[model samples]
Structure formats: structure tokens, C-alpha cells
Target: MDLSFLSEQVLWGISVGQLIVAAVLPLLGFLAQSVVRRLLRRVMSRLRKEGDLSVVDDVNRLLTRPLSFLINVALWNGVIGLLDLPEEPLSIHSWATTLGMVALILVIAYCAFHVVDVFAGIATRAAEKTETKLDDQLVAPVTNTVKLLVALIMVAAILGQFGYSATGLIASLSIGGLAVAFAAKDTLANIFGSIVIFSERPFQIGDIVEISGVEGAVEEVGIRSTRIRQFDQTVSILPNQTFTNVEVRNLSKRESRRVRFEVTLTHEATVAQLEDFLDSIRHSLAQRTDLHPDQSMVRLTKLDTNGLGVLVQAFTISTDFAEFMVTQEEILLRVRRLAEEQELPIMPAKEVRLSGEVGEPRSS
Candidate 1:
């Protein structure tokens, strides 16, 4: 190796030593980043074994790349300061500094963006420990709000770096915010409605509920809309604001379900037969464990030109619709059997009238 020849050779008006140093600076930065990453991996492994890794995992994910970029920029800046290049009309150092600053800001913004996810993960883990699911549902919206805030801050910082006044920009946005609010009123209403859902917890995922005449099981409660899987195998998407404004009946939360209907008998049924029929039906209902004994009733309700109407009203102990329907069918079947056994005909009454003299018909 000829050291004298290497020193004499010039590239970009700099000697071989300055060029070698500039090239080595980036390599050193890369090496430093690798070492830090390896250390972080080891720490993560240890934390995983300890079973308390949420915070550590979040920190590693949010800071790893930004920290590496910061180290690389710092080394490059140090190398640039050490270089003895000729200062011309266009300064290379100034351009390099500006580019470095821009990169730094970008890296910082990226870190800020990912930081929201980390915090959200931490909050979710914390929420899982408690019984209430409202906090769990809140994590997503809170994360989005935090990301938006961080993005705004990053934009402000970038503008400030470029010698623009952020105050003026913010004031301008403030003036335009009213128009934006008017334009996005429904969107904002939905977002607020989601907040209300999380706070109030009118219904939960998988709950059977009736909202705006749509009865179904709740699939997902989202920021903009709620997805409900209907009983007829159809999905209904209602805006979140609808829940806030309209009624929501959570059937799953009910303690008991009422079953009420009128059973008609023929006009030939005597009073004793009807009373016996009611007693038998009431006794059968009392035997069923699903029926609420205290709330059960069977009595003569109305008498019309059709027949005698007996009102049968009872409350089932179960709130499940399927179970309630099955129990109701069983009760009705028992009532039909009782009517057949008692010789009381279960039919609608008919009125016969002769308006004029009967005429003889010819045989065909």
C-alpha cells in the first residue's frame, strides 16, 4: 500500500483520509444500531420469560427504528463537522444538515404514530384484568384519537422547522373548523355515539337486542356503525347515532318473557266445562318448571258472536326466545289435549238464519 499516493489522490476536492472517514462514519452508525438492536432483543426475551412484557414490547416496537436513525444522523453530523471541505457558493454541509433534520423529523413522526399502538396495547392488557368491557371497547377509539393528535403535533413541528409559523396555521384551521364541523356533522355524531356506547354500555357484543325495529344479535359495535346479524340470516348495519337516539331493547337482559293469547271454544261449551278446562290448563302450566307459578293465569276474557274466549297469560322463567317458544308450544298442546278429553269442541261459533221461505231444489 502506497500511503503517499493515496494521500495525493483527491476526490470532491478532499484528500483520501477525509473520504475514508466520511465512509467509515456511516458504517460505525450501522454497527452501533445493530448492537443496540441485539441488546433490545435480549431484553425482550428476558421480559417474555418474566411474564411482564407489554410495556417493554411496546417501547421496543416504538423506539427501535427511530433510535437507530437518530444515532446514524448524529454520527453523520459529527463527521460533517470534522471534514475540511472548501466552502463554496453552495455549501454541501448546509444541504446535508437540512436533509438530516428533515429525516430526523420524519423518524420522530413515525415513532409518534406507532406510539399510539403501544399505548393502546398497554391499555387493552390493563382492561382485560378488569370485569367491565367498556374500557376494552374504548381502546380502539382512544388509540385513533391519540394517533390524530400525534400527527397534528408532528405536522406542526415540521412546519416550524421549515421556518413557518404554526400559530398562524392553527388559527387558520380554527377559523375553518366551523365549516368542517358542519360538513362532517353526521360523522362527528357517529363518533360521539360510539363514545356513548362505550360509556353507557346499553348492549354488548353477542347480546340479542331490538333496535329501530330490527331484532338481532349484535355482531360488532364500531365507531361509525353497528353490525347486527338478524334472525332471518341477514346483516343490518345501523349508524352509531341511531343507537343514541332510538330505543334499544336488550332481550337478553330480561328476567322473564310473557306469553299471552286467547283460546276460543264453541258456543256449546257449558260454564262447568269451561271452568274445568281452565283449571286443567292452569294445573298443567303449574307443573312446568319453566313457567312462573305466581304470574300464571287462565280465565274467561270475552264472549263474541264467534265463541267464548279464554285468556291464558303466563311468564316463562327463561328469557331465551327459543326456550320460551318451546315452552309455549308445550302449554298450548296440553290445553288442546284437555279440550279433547273434556269433550269441549274447540271451534268458532256460527250463526244460522232463514231470510225467506225455503225453495225445493231439483235432483241432478
Candidate 2:
């Protein structure tokens, strides 16, 4: 180990000691990066065991790599400056500085992305507390939009490092205004569609709705589309713009579901017998608490070529489909027993395509 060699010039007044320092900084930087990353990972692991938090995963994705890159770039920049590298024709110093700036911009954007996730988590918690599901639907779109803006700003900053005027280009619309407009037309329409959905509120998240012949429970309402989970467990994604000028039937909004059925009698039963049977059926439905009080009815609605038709129609107070099915089944069983008691020859009407006990119950 000669002490004189340590002070000997290596290049452009930079010593062997400085070159050794240059070589050593990167090793230290690398070690520091791994240690910090491991520490953060350990912290995240502890958090995961305590409670479920969305931001835990967000921090790992949005902070780890960019932060490590930032540390590496900073160390690299320091080494380039320490050597006093030449700036003529091509310069490592200039390259390092530009790279560092780009790295800084990226790290900042990633931090902003983490902020967006944090905001989304806060918004989601708040939305869950409210009664209206409309707020719940709004969280994703707004968060995604903000994240997208952050990404665009990050790109602009990186571009600026290379001497591109992002603002001037945007102001001039030099990329071709018509082309940009055409490109964004659908996106603009979708944004407006989301606005209309929020304002008009044809259906909320979790509502069973039928739109454009597609029926399902709305799983999510996003800026561009709506995700619907159908009865068969298949998901349907419809463009938000589709809601603008279409009919949407909110099945959840109904006060009651209609219960209707038609039964035919062989001409064996006379008018008086049929009348008494119908009255018994009406009276039976009226006594039940599940069926609507005023809506219960049984009448001879048709005098057809085949036979006399006894039509039964009522409404159930509950909106639950499973409960509605139960109510319909009870009514059908009751109607059958009543018809048999009266000694009336009854037959299920072939014309009743809805397939109910008395008739298929149609929702109203």
C-alpha cells in the first residue's frame, strides 16, 4: 500500500483516491438501496398482519422501485461530478445530470401515484359510511383520472429535461387539433356520460337494472363503462355513453312486484261456482301480510273459445326476488286448494307463457 499512489493523478486532476471513492460510492449506494427496500418490505409485512389496508400494497408498488432508482441516480451523479468529467462534444456529467432529473421526476410522480391511492382509500372509507351508493361509484373514476394526470405531468417533466416545450406544444395544439379531438372524442363522451349518470342517477351501484336488453346487478360504475354482474355470474361491460340516450329499468326502485296468473276452467263449472271460487282466492290473498292489501284481485277476465278464464293478479310488498318467489309459490298452492274445494275443473292456461302457479308473476 503506497501512500504516494493515492494522490497520483488518474485523469484531469482526479486522483487515485477519488477514483477509489468513485468506485466505492456505487457499492454503498447499492447496499443502501437494498437495506431501505428490505426495511420497507418488513414494515409492510407488519402492517399486513395488523389489519387489511389498501395503501399497504400501494406503497410497495408506487414507491419502492422509483425510490431505489432515485438513490442510485443521486450516487451516480455525485461520482460523475467528483471526477470533474469533461463537457466537450459529449459529457458524462451532463448525461448524469439529465438522468438524475428524469429519475427525480419519476420518483415524484410515483409519490403522487401513492398519494392518489391514499386519497382513493380515504374516499372509499367515506363512501362506505354513506347511505347512497352513488359516492362509492365516483371514487374509482376520480382517482384514476388524477393518476392519469400525474403520469402525463411526469412525462412532460422528463421531456422538458431533453429540451421539449410540453406546454407550448399543448397551447399551440401543434400535434394537430383535429387529430387530437378525434382521438379523444369517445373519451370526452364517456366523461360526460359519467357526469350524466352521477346527476340523473338512473341506477346506483348494486342495483339490479336492465338496460339495452342486458339485465344484471351493477357491480361498478366507472368513467368509461359500467360493470354488471348477471345472474349467471357473467360480467357485462357496457360503455357509459350507452346510458345517455337509452332506457334503463331500475328493478330496485319498484314499490312492489306484480303477481299475475291465469287459470282456465272446463265448462263444467257454472258462473256462480266460478264466482265463488274466485272470491275465495281473492279473500285468501287479501288476508296474507306479504301480498299488497289493495292490489289483490281474482276475476273472470276472459270468456274464451277454450273455456272460462280466471285471472289472478296481485302485488308483493317486498322487493327481494327470493322472497317474491316464495310469495308466488304460496299463492299458487292456495289457488289450487281453493279451486279443488269448490269442485271446479281447472286447468293451467297454455296461454300463460310466464309459467307461474296461477300465472307468471310479472314485476311492475
Candidate 3:
């Protein structure tokens, strides 16, 4: 074989060899990272089990992220060196290309891992601050905002690494702002709405609230809207911005659920019977343990030509809506039974006098 005559074929062979070297090392690096991650996780788990750490320790654990990142970067660098390209222009180009690919992978992975760490730290700090309650609505948005910012930075860094100026990318986005704004107007509105809801905290998830005249239990509070489960078992989606401008009634925040209702007395009932009726209502409410028991009051709030209006007021012992309704029903039923026992008319009264008397004063 004339070896000098096979120049082109020799170059092709070298290229194929370089490709094989580059491919195998990165695969090996990935496998090594997986093994290393598993080992680290196991060790951490063991340490967590044996160590005297308070159950509330999430901040210090995020400290592991930088070490994990360095390890991953080292493995990637090892793969690049294994390619073993020459110092010549062609070989340098190949090495630069290979390094670019490795760097891109490392950058994406590092950004993702760092975001997780940041989010974990955020959650830990939030947990430590509030003991009796948590502002959980904040975590998702705060973490997501950090992740999105980090991702954008990573992308810009990657582009800059490829010799594309990141400043130019931002400038380009600025120039395209009008179009972007027009296209994403609704999305921006939703984002603002999310911020308002998170900051104002008109109502939280699992709260029974009434907004825009619709009453329901809040099922979820999302970035763009909120989900409500109505009493009829239907789910309603309300734009988050709607809450920003509308008056939101959070029923859960009421200190005492007030029960206000009017009971009617018959026209034929005497004044003595009305007093007896009022007393019976007060006594009936006193028997329910679910009610405040101490604050029960009944009075003749109104009297019309048609009937006597007895206004009953009581405070519930619980904020729970279902229990409040049950207590209310029990009180109403008891009042009804007492009224019947005293022969107090339960229906609204209407006296029939001649219409001729409407415009004329009749002598008593």
C-alpha cells in the first residue's frame, strides 16, 4: 500500500477517530454524574436520618448545589480533554465545537439545578418566618420568577459564549417590545393580577369567598386566574385582575358568623303572645352548643299593618360554614315548634278593610 497516496482517506480516518473519542467520553461523563448523584443522595439521606437536624432545616441543605455544580462541570471538562484534538486550525475548530456543546449542556444543567436551590432556599425562609400560618401563595410566584430570570440569563450567557452579544439580544427585544406587548397584553394583565392577589391577599386558597356576586370556595389561586368551587358543585374560573378591581368578600375572616333572620307573627296574635314568641326564640338558641350561647337575642324589630317582625340574632361557635348552617336550621326549627305550641300565628297577617277607607280618615 502506498501510504502517501491515501492522504484524504487518512484525514477522514482521523476525523472519524476524533468523533468516536468525543462521543464516548461525554457518554461516560453522563453515566458518572448519574452514579455520583445517586451516591450523594444516599449519603445525604443517611446523614439526615442520623444527624440532629431540626425538622425545619431547608436552608442549609441548599448549600449542596454549588458542590454538585462543580462536580458536573469537572466531568464535562474531562470529556472535552479526552477528545485529544491537535493544535492546528482544523483540530482547534473541532475542539472548540466540542467544548461549545459541552459548555451548553453544563450551562443548562447548572441553571436548572441553581434554580432548584434558589427555590428551596425561598421556601425554607418562608417556612421559618410564619409559624401559625404560611403565605404559601407567595412561594410559587417567587420561585417561578427566579427560575424564569435565571433561565433567561442562562440563555443570554449561552448566546454570548457563541460570540453573539447578549446586549444585542436585549436591544432586539426592546425594539420588538411594541409587538410583544400587543401580543402578550392579556398575559401581562394576568401576571399583574397574580402579583396583586399575592400581595393583597384578599383571599387564600381554601377560603370561602364571594367575588363578582358569585359565592364559592376557592380551589386554586393561579398566576392568571382563580378557581372557585360553587355550592352547586360547579367550578368557576375568574380572571385574577377581576379581583384587583372588584370588592372581594372573604367570609372566612368574619370573627363571628352572624345569623340574622325575621320570623312573622299572625295578625290575630295578641301583644302577650308576641312577647312569649320572642322569649321562646331566645331560649331555643340558648340550647345549641354550636351557637355562642351567651349572645342570643330576639326582639320585635318591626311591626307592620300585615304582621309583627321578630328579628333573631345569634353568633355561631364555629367559623365552619356547614356547622353554622346546621346550627341555624336547628334554631329556626325550634322557634317554629315553640311558636306553634303558643298558638302564635306563623303566617303574615292581612286585615281586609274597605278600599273606601284608604283615602278617608275613619273615626275610631
Candidate 4:
């Protein structure tokens, strides 16, 4: 088995036996890491199904690399010690130690990213329990901020490892950052705009808002931009700065959706028939729980060559677009039925169009 050559020195007075052990250590570490990950995945899967511990699943997935890196570093450090690397000439031992330290620092930073996710998970759960919705808007931006801070710190640590003064580096960055700020003034403004949104809170997440000539439910409020998921299923990422100065109409904040439509009947339709239709509509609207009882208005406001303009205005309790559309559908269908009951021709089927906002019509 060549056991006699096991004691022979390979380099730096290290025996072949020690070199073989050092090489085998990494292989063992790899096997151990794989076994540990498999066990963790199984355990996390159980925990995820049995309880509300979804965070464990995330930790298992995200921490694999950092954990594996840790094991590799530890094994290599042991290898370095076992080899008794020389201190003089190249300072290979010192260089290796320093490199390992930098690597450990990076791994720590990497782990810090998931640490933020853990806290964010906790915050999100807590937000769900709270009655106030403003807390929900903070989770994304704060999580992003902590991650950015972690990266910046990691860069500083790496700089210091190269014998650069951390304080001096920051001072230099402060000066350089000012120039960068000037150069990327728009970015800074957007960041500040985000701050304004957080502080002022003109509209919170999930609010159906019309802002900056765009209409949608606010999907996310990020550091530099606001994401609006439009009605057409497209997402518009507008600069945060765009919201700071523009008019923001929070449509969802309203108590009820304002619905206004003109139902035109034939010019030959009499005042008595129109009045009867209006009275019937008002009575029918009062019976519905979705509409505000006192607010329903059905008036014959116009008599022209075109037709008799029967203006129908009411406020629906629904704030959501789809729900409001359903309400509109029911009301329009009802109006048509009433016109048919009176044997009045509608000229053709009437159409409802969105002009200004949900249930709000544009001026003629």
C-alpha cells in the first residue's frame, strides 16, 4: 500500500500522510454540506407544512451558499495550519489567512442579506395583524435600504483588507459622492421623493390612484420609483419624483363611486312617460344596498332634436374598478328594461365609457 512513503516529506517538512489528510478534508466537508442541506430541506418542508414557518424554507434555500462557503473556509484554514506554510519570502501563510478573512467578511455580508429577509418576514406578518395600512408600504423600501447598507459595508471592509483606511475612504467617498450626487441629481431627487411619499403618504399601497397621468392600483413604492399595475395588466414604473409635484387622486379613498350617465330616449317621448321612468328608476335604486339611497338622480335634463336626455346619477358603495363595473352593468341593463317596458326606443344600445376616473365622467 506504499505505507513506507507516507512519512516522506512533500514540502516544508510536511509528511505525505498530512497532505493526503488535508486533501481528503475538503471532500469530507463537501459530503457533510450536501447531507446537511438535504436534511434541512426535509425538515424545513415539514415545518412549512405543519406551521406558518415559511421563513425556514427561505433560510434553507438562501443560506446554502454561505453555509457551504463557511465549511470550505474552515476546512481550508485547517489545511493551511496542517501544512505549516512558511512565514518568509512570499508570506504565503499570511496571504492565505488574510484572503480567508476577506472571504469570511464577504460570507458574513452575504448572510446579512437573508437576515434582512427574516426581519422583513416578521414585519410583514406584524403588518398583516395591524389595522393601519400605512405599515404595509414601509416593508419593501426598508428591506431594500438594509440590503444596500449591507453591500456598502461589505465594500468598505474589503477596502480596509487591502490596507486602505476606512475613515479616509469614507471621507473621500463623501467628497466623491457629492460630485456623484450632482451628476446624478435626478436619482437623488427621486430618493428624496420616496422620502416624501413615506412621510406624507399621499397614497398607500393597493390604493387605486390616478397620478402623473396614469391610473392603476399602486403595486409598490420603491426607493426611486412607484410601480402602478394598470387596468390593462401592464406595469408602469414612474419616477418617485413624478408623484411629489403632481396631483394625486386616490380613487379608492372615496366612500362611493360616482356614476353618471345620460339615457337618451326618443324625441316623441312625453314628459309624463319620462317622469314615470325617473320615478321608477329612483324607486328601484333605493331598494338596492349597493347604491346610496338619497343620492340617486334620474332627471329629464335635455330635450333636443337628438332625443330626450334622461340623466342618471348615483353613487355606488364599491370602490374597486371591477366591482364598480358590475354595478354599472346591472344599472344599465335595468335602465334598458325600464325603457322597453315604456315601449320607448333607445335609438340604439347605449354605451358607457370611462373618461376621468372610475365612475367619473368628463365634462362636455
Writing each residue's lDDT as its tens digit, candidate 3 over 200-228 gives 67777778899998899898878877889
> Which candidate's TM-score is highest?
1
Better candidate by TM-score, 1 or 4: 1
TM-score of 1: 0.81
Better of 3 and 4 by TM-score: 3
For candidate 4, write residues 296-341 as lDDT tens digits: 8888888877777889999998777778899998998998899889
On lDDT, the leading prediction is: 2
Evaluate model 2: give its TM-score. Answer: 0.71
Off by over 4 Å in 3: 1-49, 52-98, 101-105, 108-134, 173-175, 348-364
Local accuracy of candidate 2 as per-residue lDDT tens digits, 1-364: 6699988997767899889999999999989988998999888988898776665776676668767877877886788778877676677668878887887787778778877887787799989998879898898879888988998989899989999999887878855988989998998888898899988888898899999989989998888888999999999999988888899999999999988989888888888998799789978987999987887878887786788888899999999999999999999999889888888888554663454456557677
The candidate 1 region of ten consecutive residues with least summed lDDT is: 355-364
lDDT of 1: 0.82
TM-score of 3: 0.69
Which is superior by TM-score, 1 or 3?
A: 1
| Rank list by lDDT | 2, 4, 1, 3
Q: Which ten residues in a row have the lowest lDDT in candidate 4?
A: 52-61
lDDT of 1 at 205: 75
Please give, for residues 59-155, the per-residue lDDT of candidate 1 as tens digits.
Answer: 6888687788778778866776666545576777677666667767777777777777887888899988977565676788778878888788877
Q: Model 1 Cα displacement at 222 (Å)?
A: 1.7
